[model samples]
Target: MSKTILEDAIQEELSFFLQAIHECVHTDFNCNRVLNNAVANIISSVVSGKRFEYTDPLFVKFMKCLDENIRNIGTANVLNVLPIVRYLPGDLFKFKQTLRNISMIDKEIIRPFIEDNRNNYDDSNVTNFTSAYIKAIQQRRQEGQNTNMSDGNLETCLRDLFIAGSETTATVLRWGLVYFLNYPDVQEKCFQEILENVGQSRRPSMKDKTSLPYVEATVTEILRCADIIPSSLPHSVPHDVEFRGYTFPEGITVLPMLSSALHDPDLWGDPRNFRPDRFLDTEGKFQKMNEHIPFSLGHRACLGEALARMELFLFTTSMIQEFEFRPVDGVSPSLQGLPGIVYRPQQFNMKAIPRAK
Candidate 1:
């Protein structure tokens, strides 16, 4: 798709999200409405073979469940360590229970489809990822391969993909907006670059990203400063592995601290500041840095990296090109990151003023 087309899709998706939020806000005081709207949009986009939109009903429901689960999981972590909280619980244990309920709902959504197509597969309705996987499993089974296309495994994979992709991307986008509002200079620079390089007639494209080096750099810097995933997902060492003259025993849970590496002063000069220039060389070309790995690294790196990158590039560029982000009057953008499974900007509001030309 052309850059303009992709951007239009993103704008539409955002509009849908806002509409969903507005429609449900009175009835649903919790953020679950917003979450559901976002997820539903994604689901509709994937299923309908259109650009992802967050306002779709299914997506909104899925997002609500996902958000509840994430919050519940976070609470569970706290309660596991702080026994007092668990013992005196009214809503404390309920949080973990909510996660279980969400998990059951996720399985309910995915399981029936897998079971129905376990014997005979239909390729006609290959809109969602679950359907695609079902088709693949059927094909593999027909080829005499003993593939375990069980409902349990399929549900697990789908659940993981949904949670991993939706939460991470959404959190990053939230942080990007927060930063843009806080740093007007940076935001204006990005807006000017997008307008000058891509123009209003067309939306920003991945190809245009090369010409718009500063825009790309701004994104990289946002990811760097945001430090979305502070630590890599836990992994057990396969065997006795020696790294930098330190030998770690097998089966030891290893947590690679990504924040330190991304923000290391030695690796990135003055890493704390929000400097997009750090991602650019003297010649102004986008510079590749080893310290940059917002999606983690190695075999366990995110499988949705391509999709996430496309979403980020399209959404960030389009938003900046169309609107100037600034903090609401008398309100300062909160830079404090909310502690969660993925670190994200605290709740903040910004005015998206339409850009003329």
Candidate 2:
């Protein structure tokens, strides 16, 4: 089911990219907006069984809200440690405002879909996550089992899946473009690999990944350098646990410093450099490392990791195969982007020159 959804999304994403480039009169474009909408549409289809056009007003507003809320939420905030801080003015930390914005999204954006799913609930036909959840709630009631799949809970879950699943992938792609623009040689290598593996007559797929080792390594390097989610979400230690001679008591909040491993000098030599060769073995094949935990580790790792991987590979290869990305007007974009919930590249324009077939 997930594979089908991703395959459909990759096709749509490639079409959207082509359309965006064609519409650019001067060949100048904002890759960030195009990438964000492309990714968000995937989640929109999965969660609500509907995909919105890029220019849809309500959909644009919802995207804006998600972007703002994500930016407002950094690695860690004082509100998490002190509940009293939220009682202060909304302008102080933007905490209350962020919550209010998200609540509006839940009420205005998610509630309507939940209502529709509930009204049209069916036992056998489960088209999307919303429908499957509604069906589960009904089935649980029929069996008289204790289930918490209430409308509100369902709405929150859907919202989480939509935002988390969309924004992270979009940010990573945006950064990927930035890196490629900064390093044209790397971009050309990726394009060459894609061309040799998957010809211009067809779109690239997961099967092409093995044949395009450099492309795979390039994607790995982009994720390592971008560090979208530098700090994983807060995880609680259930009971007193001791690891490496350190005792962590029960109920302690643990923040997995992923950057520590991703940028470790011993693990990754010259970890600060944007080099895809680090992920490639001497034989020119992609090398998988235990330290390469971009989606993170453990059972509670990213639920959408598989989908994200497919999106990254397919969308990136499609773009490289179709266009040669370059900085607009010979202006280079800064690598150090504004850090929010995710590390985002700076707002910079770029040109996607069509490649000769």
> In terms of lDDT, which candidate is strongest?
2
Write the residue-wise lDDT of candidate 1 on 175-240 in tens digits.
Answer: 788778778889888888887788898766777878988988998888888988899688888899
Cα displacement (angstroms), candidate 2, residue 34, comes to: 1.7
Backbone collision tally, model 1: 9
Tell how far residue 43 is off in model 1, in angstroms: 5.4
Clashing pairs in 2: none
Where is model 1 more than 4 Å wrong at Cα? 1-36, 47-61, 78-91, 112-128
Candidate 2: list runs displaced more than 4 Å. Answer: 85-90, 120-124
- Model 2, span 122-169: residue lDDT tens: 767677789888878878999999987798788779888977998899
lDDT assessment of candidate 2: 0.84
- Model 1 worst lDDT window (10 residues): 24-33
> Residue 177 in candidate 2 has what lDDT?
89
lDDT computed for candidate 1: 0.69
